[model samples]
Structures are given as structure tokens and as C-alpha cells.
Target: MPDRLAPLTEALLAAAQKAGAEAADAMAADGRAVSVDVRGGALEQAERAEGTEIGLRVLIGRRQACVSASDTSARTIAEMAERAVAMAREAPEDPTVGLADPAEVARIWNLSALDLADPAAEPGAAALEDDARRAEAAALAVRGISQCQAASASYSRQRIFLAASNGFAGGYTRTSRSTSAVAIAGEGLGMERDWAAESRTYQSDLPSPEEIGALAGRRAAERLGARKPKTGAWPVVYDERIASGLIGHLLAAINGASVVRGSSWLRDAMGAQVLPKGLSIFENPHRPRISSSRPFDAEGLATAPRDIVRDGVLKSWTLDLGTARKLGLRSTASATRGPSSPPSPSISNIALTQGDRSREQLLETMGTGLLVTAMIGSSVNPTTGDYSRGASGFWVENGQIAHPVNECTLAGNLRDMLMRITPANDARAHLSHVVPSLLVEGLTLAGE
Candidate 1:
């Protein structure tokens, strides 16, 4: 591969400076990906894509504008810079928008320690097709599995570079591989579907196709005879597969962008108890071999581990430079951005404290409740924390699974839900959000 991105970003920065911008930043990304899908034990689709893109953000006084293009020619770069500068000149001034101070930029990073990219050669298209076909065949082999809806295998690699006029430049490469299978059980109106997937930064770390297919088949078979549970307020146990979404709600509420806009339910939750005592949410951006792990943020700021929630108390807000300044706080180095957008607050690798008990133990302790394994549409009131969603899962009675249930509405206020959650020790360690199965007490379920 050509070392073309570094010079491209540098060129964008130089163009922006020549266009008479007060400050500027530039980003470049080169990526390639291949994907294969199989169904009915045959290749359904195969795709390969490769592209390079560059973006320029120029600041005129306190106003800024971002523009991106796939073309890297010098003429195009100059035009992009000129357009961005013109747009910035006409845009309303936002005093908080500008490049990070030179001292605040990440001065050093260790990409090797992070192990973000795999060193192995890319898998051939035929190999990907074989993986997908195997997964589909395995699912079809399972008893009670009516069909393999879809099976897929994919691999991607991307290199990103960032350069700013304030003397900051950094770049990194990342790779990912994933396999998934979706299976259907029963026939006609009784058919139910479920899926299983595994993704890793390296191909060697991905779960086997057989394992993924078997899990998908089993999950679908388990839902073969799903019915609605009796309507009432019940304790709800979110299965490990879906439990991360509950924590995701909390994360969104504490996002600096939401907080600044007064749109988050957790706007006033700093230093307050948002989770059960002894539970904490930790962010570690430098975790090795994790897809979300990063040595530095999009704005070239150094990232480090921090406790977003400590012992149930709301501790910090996810922040980028702009949102931090808007709130009169220091940047948390949580900035994330794409080629066509400016940096914004976002989280990387995070893990919630796990409870001592296993998921089975938690189920036994609950005695009678709904064990939600999947959810559909959502209606969440961001400002008030009101939450309601369509859910489907197994119902627990007398400490055992009685039957699968579906078409139920789970309703509760998120502000109150997190306070009463009991985590089960079932989190997948390699996930970006390592939240375990969670049991929240007293949620209303609208069912039969």
C-alpha cells in the first residue's frame, strides 16, 4: 500500500492555511472490506470495496466548516479548502469551536501495545464464502431449525490519519473480522427467528462458524412456541445479549452533547446515584485487541481509563473538546468523528461491574419474572427518562423457565430502573460494552 494519506492530510492542512483560515485540521482514511453471505448452502452474495477519503475543517475566527471528498488531486484539495473557508466565513460564530491547544494534543502513543490491527494476510474471497456456507449448513443441520435465514462472514481493514495546523499529527490502523448466523424455527405463522454473531479485531480471535450457527439454531428453537405472559408488574431480567442496551441508555443520558443541550435525563445526575451501590462503569480506551480501543481520540487527544460511574454515583460526562468548553469543563478525550463530520463526544471500550452471582443464580433468586432476551421498537423520553419497548423472552416461574413470551411491552423509568438493577456474571469480556445480564425490579409488562 502507498503511504499516501499522510501527505494527503498535510496537503489539506496546507490548503486550508493558504485559504486564509485562522486554524484548521484534516483527516484521511483508506479502507478495504470484503463480505460474503450464504443461504440454503449456496453463496448469496459476495462484495469487495476499497476507497480513500479526505476531510478538511477550517476555522475562520470562531466559526468552522468541514468538507470531505474522495478525490485527492491537488486542485480538488484546494477547492475543498476554499469552499470550507467560505462556508466558515458565513457561518455563525461558535466561540468554543477551534483546534486543541498544542500542549493538549497527544504527543506519543503505542499502537503495538493496543494490538488494534491483525498482522495476518487478508482472507481470500473464497475463504469467506466457505465460512459463510459452513455456518449456514451447520444451522440447517440442527433439529427443529426450519431454515438458515442468513449466514455471513466479513473482514475489513482501515487506516486513519489526522493532522492539525496546531502541530498535531497521528495515525493508526485497525482490522476486524466477524461471522454471524440467523436461523428460523417452525413453519408459517409459528416461525420465530434468532441470530448469533461474534466479532474480533483479529480473524484468529473470532468464534468458530459451528459455534455461531449452533447458538443461533438453539436460540431460534427455544422461541418455537412463544406466547404472551400474564399482564402485570414483574421483575425483568435482561439477558446478557441485550443487557448492554440498558447500560447504553445510561450512557446516552450522560453524553456531554445531550447534557449540554439539556436533552439528557441525567442532566442533573452528576455526583448522584444512578446505579445500585457497588456498581461502577469504567471506560478503558487502551484495552488490547478490542475493536473500540484507541490510543488517541479523533482530535489527537490522548485517551486514558476513567470511571464514568463510581460505586453507583454519576462521575463524569463523555466529552469532546467542543462540548467540554460549552460546559466550562476540560475535555475528557472522548472525541469521535467521521470523514465528513467534526469531532463529537463518544465513548470507547467500557465495562460495568459484574455481580457475584451467575445468570442462573439470578434467575433462581427472582423466582417469578420476565427474562427478556430480545427487544424491538423503543419509545424513550430522553429528558424525563421514561422508557418503553417491545420485548420477547422466556418467563420464569418458581425459579425455572416456564415458556417463551412475546409481544409484550416493558415499561419503566430509566432513572429508577438503574438504581435497582442486579447484575449477573455473564458479560462477554471482549465486547465494547461489557455489561452483564441485569435484573431490574418492578417493571410493568403489558401482555395477555
Candidate 2:
């Protein structure tokens, strides 16, 4: 654990005792970040962020109370602890929740796996800004391209420590880096803009700057003269990126927290055939290149590979220690936390199984359909598996791409979408979801 953590944990416990409380815990984290963005081949943004936050929780009898602070002063941490203890004494009692049992809190394992201090993740501010500048300049140089909306480079490093009265103590540190490029193209009467973004836990995994710039330029140029297609039901093709976003939707429904609340659409769908016969989705905390990969979850439990969906049937639920206690089921080491807070249910890496076909082959089979490359917003009701969102992409016709389209809406229920899915032979392990281009047989498209 970070040296800054122990004192506060002791302080919270002492304060809780003074308030006649039974238990207490404290978590604190500090970090720094640098980010830069460019537009029209000019510096649009260059900034750095450094911050620290500490929080304390106290349990009085059956009641619990918590408080947090951005200030790291000795007086502030102690004050936060006192306040939490005081609040716990005044709050209503809840018999169901408290700190993890002493026996159940897993030992904190090696922390080296979480380190991301390499050249890629720790690239200096100048290097990061240069990446953004190079990418943006290339975008503006694209043939027929007018300008760039934005090009950005960013890197961040953070560390956290969590300690509780029940002999639970642990912490880890990691870094993140990302880059993106965007551009506008077309004649005066018909113009369009598009963007490409890439991110990784390690800086070395970032695509070459030239590659990023060229892809952005080509994508924007391709969208020139984009027009809306006829409104009707049509097959939908999910790009590698779009398919990854869909997997995020899957995590929410399969997590134990949502199901316990009776809010997950998968609450009653266990053991049922949810996907195609050969499809499977596994949560792998050990995936080598992902930022989210970890040896254990937020609650300090070992995280191993977990199959949430196997051979088309529902498999297991991602869980935290608290939820596992309530549900009487073993956890899959899916605990996650935001900032330096309590554990929450979350997956590590989402590795979707792929078929043995190329993306090109999948498009050939599509004949005529919409290829969704980017999603603007998330509008999924996890409880009901209902979804509708704004989308932009190109139209596929006669076994080839025909024209670009924009300002369209793709609406469908996830349940039905899964059933109608006609899997493509192409699946790649990129993006957070690690899915392939997906083609669905039926859907409703709304456009002008």
C-alpha cells in the first residue's frame, strides 16, 4: 500500500471507536495527466491535470457513513474521518451492508502487472503534443480536405490505496495514453468530416502517427457527398469499433449488481440460448495489451478468465465481494472501482470469439446494408434490453460500398438483435469489446 494510506486508515478506525462505531476504512489516490488537442493544423488545447483525493468510511453499529476530500493535509484526512464517524452515529441502520468479512478479503498479489510507466504511457508532454500536431497537419493535407475538427494526444498516471479494518489492504498504479485524428472533406456544396481514435494502456501500442493521419484523411474524404438512404428495414453491419461498443452493453446485463436489482434484462435468461450456437464471450483479466487487465478486482480478489456467455448460452455473472455474499455465489474476480472508492462489479477484458472469415467476405454477403462505423451516444435500457442510438456510416450495395450517410438513427432491442445476428467470419481483438464486424438481418433505419 502507498505510505500515505496507513495513517488515514488508522485515523478512521480511531474516530469510529470514539463514536462507538464497530468498523471503518479509508482509501486515497493521487495522479497526474497531460493532454493536447489540435484543430486545422493549429494548437487548440494543451493542458495538464494533477489531483489527489482521499475518502473515509465509518460504521457505527449497523449504520455507515462516508466522506471524501481533495485536500491531502493531515488535518483534512483526520477531519474527514471524524465527520464520517459522526455521520454514521446519526444515520439509519442497515443490517445488510458493511465491510468485507476478514476471511473473504483476498490477499493483495503482485502489483508489477499493473505498471504502465513505459515510454508509451509516460511519453513526455512535448512528445504527446507533437503526435497531435503531426496527425492534424496530415489530415488538413488530405486531398479535397478542408480542415480538421480535432486531433488529440493524451497520457495519464495514477495510483490508489484501499485499506479497511478487516485486515484488507491493497493498492495499484497504472498509466493510459491515447491519440486521435479528424478531418473534413468535399466540395463547397457537399462536405463531410470524420474521425479516428486509438487508445492503449501502453504508449507503444498506439498506431503510428502517419497511419493515424492517413486513415482520418481517407475516412473524411470517403464521406464527401454523403446522403441519406431510403428509409426502410435493412441489414446492419457493425464495424470492428461498433461491435466493441455492443459488448459494453453485454457487460451491464450480465453483471450481478444489475441482476440483483431486478433491473438486468438477463435477470431470468440464465442457461438460455442467448447467442448463436458457436458464439462465446469471455472476460479475461489477463489479456496482454488491455489497460483494464488486472490480476484481481477492486475488492482485492484474484481475477481469472470468466465466461459470461458460452456456446450461445448464458454462463456467469460478474460480481464483487459484497454482491457475492448476498447472492450466495462465488465471485469471478470482477470487482472494479471508480477513483478510490469501494468495490463495484466490472469485467477486465472482453474477448469475443471470432468466426473464420474476413471483414471483406462479410461485406460481400451483406449485398446491400448499412455499415455503422461510429456511435454518437448510448441509449440502452439494460433492464429491458431496449436500445436506440444515433449513428453514421456508409451504405453497402452490390457487394461494395456505395455512398456515405449521416444523421441517421438505428433502433432495435438487443434481444432481437442477438437473435437476428448473422455472424461474420471476421473478429479481431482490438478496442475494448474485442468484437468483429457484425451483420444483423433485420432492423429499422430512420433518416431524412
Candidate 3:
């Protein structure tokens, strides 16, 4: 791996400027990954891979163009830079676009939270193959779990850096560990398929192999005794996974870019109740536990805790410096950047505050409501807040979970559901969103 990108970045920046570009930035990244599959207690597939790419962003006054390639030779890099500048010169120019403002770049390089150079993160072929064997063995040990469709483990890392004509320079390395299993349970009428996985930025944060297997096994077992519920309007229960997914959808609505673009349902909803009162959603970029936490945003802006939604009302929109300046709103430090795309708004370590009712009590109170485990799909018009999705889960009847149901549709306008949410206890150890179980009424559940 190349330790110093200064020489390469300067070369590219100079080349772009020579091509009539007013500003330029270059970024490069390299990483490795491993994946595996398991079936019938046997290893199915195994692979290891690594590669790197360099990208160039050039601005001809206001118009900007980006181009990237895997080749790293100086000749190729220079050509890439020149081409990017030429394209920018020909493209439409707009003042709202360019690299992040120079003022926001990170001056101090911080690697305190990351293990950028740990070779152990990238296991050898033999060890990676062994990991798959171990995961499958653990899954098969669980009683009633006859087999698994797949079991896999992976560790990967990325070393990235960016240099721009504005005199800002920065970069960081990140690592990830992921393990997953898909299991089969029962036979025929009672047969069910379920999957579960755990991902962590640090390998040490991942659960033990046995624990991973247990989760996959438990998910499959809990899905047994399936049946279809008589669909009608009743209270709806959203488990942690589904609840987190719903929250994922909400993040985009609060994105500052979307609001400015006039494409978000939240365009005029600020200060208005969006969820049930007492419901709070916090986006804290500096939170230590989350994999998504960042001290500085992708655009190099200092990140701060933001109340995206508070007491059931829209609070602040996610804002990057560019959008913030355009809209006359303060930057919320929500800028997110991928390797190739420019910075955009993203909520970091978002959490919906916990509620008081316990999961058990919330389930018991359902008493003839649909306990939605998985939302089969999300088909929502963010502009209209119209949401309808296929759902599957157990039926709660008279204080107990009865049987699994399928082919049910959960239909409700998000604007309406927001105010109707009845949150429950058990927020800790939920999904990434950390939302508690929730109860909602006044939705149409269509069935016979």
C-alpha cells in the first residue's frame, strides 16, 4: 500500500489545473475481503479478494466532473485528471456544487478509533476457510436446526485519503467484521427459513461463534407454526428489526438535500408533530458504540448531536455545508461521502428513544393484533407519505403469540402512523436503530 498520497495528489491537481480546472481533489482506496458459504455441514464456497482505485474530481470554475479508475500508473492518473477537467469545462455549471468548503477539512489526522494497519484483519486463505467451518458447526449444533443455506464470515479494510486544491488534506482507514447464517427449520407445513447476521467495525465487538449460531437457530424456530391471519384494521406491532428499517426510511426524509430539492415529505412539516409525543430521534455522530460514528463528517465538518425528530415533531433537517449554506440553515454535520460520490447528508448513530412499556406487556396488550416481524417490502412515496408493504409475523391473540401469518399487507399513510405509534420497552440490544417495540392503531390490514 502507498503510505504517502501527497505526490500523486499534487500531480493530479496540477494536471487538472493545467487543463483549465480551477480546483481539484483526488482520492484513492484499497481493501481486501473474504466470503464463504456452508450447506449440510460442509463448506460450499470460499474466496478472498483485494483491489484499489483512484478517483479525480475537477471543477472548471463551477461545473464539476468526476472520474475514477483502478489503474494507478502516473500516465493513467494524469490522463484521468485531464479528462475530468475537460469534462467539467463542457458540463453545465452551477454555483451550488463543488468539493466541500475548504474551511471544514479535518486538520488533525485521528486514528484513535480505527485499526488501519492491522494485518490480522485480513485473514489468510486457510484461516478464512476455517472460519466458515466453525460457523457451520455451531449452527448445526442447535437442536431442530437440520441444515443451513449458508454461513459466512468476512473481514475487510479500506485505506483512504483525499487531497484538494483548496489546501486541505486528510484520510482514514476503516475495518469491518461480518458473519451471517441462514437456517432451515421443521418440515412441510411447519417448515420455515430465517437468517441472522452480526456486523461490527471492530472484530472484537462481534459476538462469539456459538452466540451467532444460536441467534440463527432461534430465528428459524420462532417462525414455526405459520398461518394466515384474518386481516382487518387492528393495532400493529413492529419488532426491533422492522422498526429500525422503518427508521431507516425516515432518515432520507429528514436529509437536508432532499428538503432543499423539494422532494421530501418533510418539506413543510418542521415544527409539526410527526410521531407520537415523547418520541425522540437523536443523531449523534460522535457516539462511541456505533459503527457509523464519526467525529467529523465526510465533508470534514465537525459533527454534533442533532434532534432530527423530537416529541413527535420534525426538528432539524440533515445538512451538509453546501446545502446548509444554500438553504440558510446551519450545517447539521450530516455530510456523508462514498469513494466516488460527493458528500451528502447522512444521519450518524441515530436512535429513537426508548419507551416505557415492556415488550411482553406490549405484546400482551395487542390481543388480536398482528405482530409484524418482517416488512416484506417498503413501497412509499416520500412526497406523499403513502406507505403500503407486505408483512409477515405471528398473530397475537389474547395475550399470547399464536402462529405465523403470511400474505398480509400493512397499509397506512406514514403521516398518520407517525402520530399513532405506541412505543414499548426493551430498547437495548435491539437493532442498530435501538428503537423499542411499537404499537400502532388505525392502519388498514387488508385480508379476509
Candidate 1 deviant stretches above 4 angstroms: none
lDDT of 2 by residue, 293-404 (tens): 7765655566777778999888888887667766777777787665335567877777777767677777888889899887878788988998898888998897688998
TM-score against native, each model: 0.99, 0.91, 0.92
Would you list the rank order by TM-score, best first?
1, 3, 2
Task: Please identify which of the two predictions, 1 or 3, would achieve the higher lDDT against the true structure.
Answer: 1
Of 1 and 3, which scores higher on TM-score? 1
| lDDT per residue (tens digit) for residues 43-124 in model 3 | 7777777887777888876788888888878788878877887788788967777666677666763456433334344656
What is candidate 1's lDDT per residue for 247-349, written digit by digit as tens?
9999999899999999999999899999989999999999999999998898889999999999999999999999999999999999999888999999999
From the highest lDDT down, the ranking of the candidates is 1, 2, 3
The CA-based lDDT of model 3 is what? Answer: 0.75
* Candidate 2 positional error at 259, Å: 1.5
* Candidate 2, residue 390: how far the Cα is off, in Å: 2.4
